[model samples]
Target: MPIEVKNELGKIQVMNEVIATLAGSAALECYGLVGMASRNQFKDGIAELLGRENLRRGVEVRHEKDRTEIDLYIIVSYGTKISVVAQNVQAKVKYVMNEVIGLQVNTVNIFVQGVRVA
Candidate 1:
């Protein structure tokens, strides 16, 4: 007997995972970024199982018909200047997302979550 599989066509919403991964990778590229963690980490065991997801919380993407909005939360090294670090992060992330993902980003919001002593 042959089994038939049903294919469901699903509307793909802008993947939060992809956004997070991009943001995390961009932030890490900066010299001052020490680490990042998502607010979701406190909720479940998600951080332990899916470490990448935890990093993705640093980025929030709101998709619209014409554009996408991105919000980033990050941690910087204690000695780094917050303003400069934030600017670097914004620039890098925007460039990467625009060039690599080819998404029209409407805005990039940067939030400094913490400063890592080390």
Candidate 2:
């Protein structure tokens, strides 16, 4: 189901794919992030890097009860701190979703799929 937003003018519906794309874009802006990874890319302990066009495919958005959650599959640079990168991604995703799209993102779960050399 698409999320509904109400303003003084009218009510608007936003699809989950749109939200996922926005979240994925925000995530890619962070330092040390190589790119997004496919959600189902765990074959033989490897993750496939997704291109810019597959932003929505790399992210999973779940709206349950009164909470909104986003799961980001990512590949980080080999030399960067994994923990720091994940933290930044979480903060950025929430900020962009709330500020740009008017969507309140409650949780951002970052799954480090792989690490690649920059």
Cα error, candidate 2, residue 111 (Å): 0.4
Clashes of each: 0, 0
Candidate 1, pairs of clashing residues: none
lDDT of 2 by residue, 3-118 (tens): 98788999989999999999999999999999999997677888989999998889999999889999999999999999999999999999999998788888999999999987
Say what the RMSD of model 1 is.
Answer: 8.7
TM-score of each: 0.72, 0.96
Cα lDDT of model 1 by residue, 7-115, tens digit: 3654334456776688778878898887665644433432222245466766777766666677877777889899999899888888987676556577888877666
Candidate 1 has an lDDT of: 0.69
lDDT of candidates 1 onward, in order: 0.69, 0.94
Error of 1 at 101 (Å): 1.2
Off by over 4 Å in 1: 1-14, 40-53
